[model samples]
Target: MRLLVSFLLAGLITDGEAQNWHGPHPWRANAVVDGRARDYNNEYFLHAFSYRHLIDRPSPIEEGIRGTAGSLTSDRLYMDFRYQQSFAFDDPDQAFTLDIQRAEDFDGSYDRQLVGFRQTLAQRWQLSLQGDVFSDKSLTDIYFGARRLHSEGSWLQLSLVLPNAYFNDKTDSQSELIDEPRTLFAQWHQQHTPWASTTLSVNHTPDATLDDRTQGDRVSSRQTRVALRYREQKGNWQLQTDLNGEHTRRQHQLDERPAPQAFRRDMASLTLAVRYWPHRWQPQVGARYFWLDEDGWFGREPNGNGEVSRQEPMLFGGMSLSLSDTQRLAPTVYLSRPRVEQTVNSPRWRDRDDHGFVGKLSVPWHITVSKQNGAVLSIVPSMRLHRFAFGGGNVQLHWPL
Candidate 1:
């Protein structure tokens, strides 16, 4: 369709800056700053950055205005919002939909928005186009998706995501830059019976490279992931299970370096949850297992070679009790022992083994807004403890628009 082609072309004008290093572990710049070394740690900063980059970091007030919490060198919290509306065109089946969303991470590092449009075709197929726009108004990525409806509660969907990039000027300071990577996503869902259903999904990102200006840091990576989910409900009881696995490979190089360093990572996790509902009270229990392995160079040669692995199994339980017709209180507790092993050949850093018991508690208040549309708002306050000592705590609010 001509409209679809125009949407795809719109993706090309997205702002694209050179991607940065994405090694498994944090990477320190070759140069030091103010008696300390500069480092790049995505997990902490929400993006890759070193000491020099801190100057450009947003202040707490700025973060708050954006509805994000947490900061570098501090704990993280997130606030997410979503709203959607649809309008019918000349034909009843031809509709234009607008979806707006904001999502951030616990640490306030990742923030994204979604702008979408959807159209119905043949009464069974739907075509959707969505753009991932950042707070700065720069387009990061776009998704084209098609869904085929087989019947109620059953469908098949496919999507392709293209990362946008552009060249400043071949001779200018900003040369070729690709801000993000391209990806392919697929999903299938089926409802065998009124009480049972299953879903499977796959996500793959082929090899992609980020080349900075004339000369700077460059990185390349490839990844694949698979996930399965199943749910069943009967007689006021609900059960759900989820399985996921992912593998990633990365190569990094400094400007004009002899060769790039290689890094590999593998992650797998499984979770099972069950809920029993009774009049005004509902109780739930869940178990989860998570594992990760990483081996690669984190920074410049001779200093970043290392291997790290972690495994954790956890159990959690919770219950919800209705306090009023539209209000309920839910409390949950979690317990886990995580073990991590790191082996590195470096002087400033030493190989070590760390394991500890971690516990967390959460109390959330839920209020129903629109019973017909199943809209609700939740306010959650949580606390954490490690080795019986107070670790940290956070409060989060979830509201649907």
Candidate 2:
């Protein structure tokens, strides 16, 4: 489960060139209708690149991976690039990521490297910094962050994560694991008019970290979250709603327990969505509910009977077809049912409800109607069907690189 990989990074260059400027539309509505660059998204394409390939067999996790990424934006330099490599017939692993934002912000066989930045302070506070160096320094990582923006759709952010988590740990196999993560993000939105809208959010991470090298213990974890969202449109119908809550704390250490086990996790979720465009066709429906309440020690006040608990119910539907203006087609379906209720000395609890249903299809094509230098190319094909007889498909080609 920890076979990580990465290809090239760090002001990279060595027979693997050309990687950024933007627009690789594999979806997201075909990159908002063919990377709609509102006229040179402010001096566009200084650099942008991509190349990707992936194959996954969803019946016992067969795997393959390849990735490459590039990006560059200026006015103050910004690049968000990444690389990934992974494989399996047994074991293989890799990782990579590089980012520099406010300027704005890949690939297999790649080893590892990450660099990040985002700075802006007089015109509405902002600060960001990232790091992840490799060549095996235990695959280090330490990120930085800050943010602020107010006026109408307010904003605030915070990020700090130290990753290198999990690569070895089956109670000791040259134990290695890392997780010192932090996050605090905020948002606010309002539009009591034009249609209807309101959103409020908060995501908090209580400095979590756990480095237990089989007893060289250093455990700590705490998570947080809060959310509220609402949206509406009228005249074709479109609406969305969400409410979320999460809190988790985990501290564990065992080599025959010498006092070092504290666990607590709780989650709550709710979502509702509805859509109905109708011209180019679009029909959607959604419903979601999730809850997990259990875990002992550390102020044990969850009363959902602990050891661990879970309850999930979900259903979603979708359809979209806009076979023109850059071609499009989408289909989606989802269903989930989860129930654990509680577990302490459990044995899969006899499959815990094991509910299922999944189906997806997407076809996006934008064979440029004409445009050379500002690069544009897209082709997306994806398929998924899983229930009893699982299925899978993939085809992606995003130009540049």
**lDDT for each of the candidates?**
0.51, 0.39
Q: Can you write out model 1's per-residue Cα lDDT over 262-301, one digit (the tens) per residue?
A: 8787888777777775545567788877677777765443
Index of the highest-TM-score prediction:
1
Instruction: Report each candidate's C-alpha RMSD, comma-separated, in the order given.
Output: 11.3, 23.0
* Total clashes for model 2: 28
Q: Give the TM-score of candidate 2.
A: 0.29
List pairs with backbone clashes in candidate 1: 46-109, 76-106, 77-106
Cα error of candidate 2 at position 239, Å: 0.6
Those runs of model 2 whose alpha carbons end farther than 4 Å from true positions after fitting are 1-185, 188-193, 196-200, 208-221, 226-230, 236-238, 243-247, 252-257, 264-270, 275-286, 293-306, 314-338, 344-401
Cα lDDT tens digits, model 2, 271-313, are 6767675445566677766665645432211211135455656
TM-scores of the models, in the order given: 0.70, 0.29
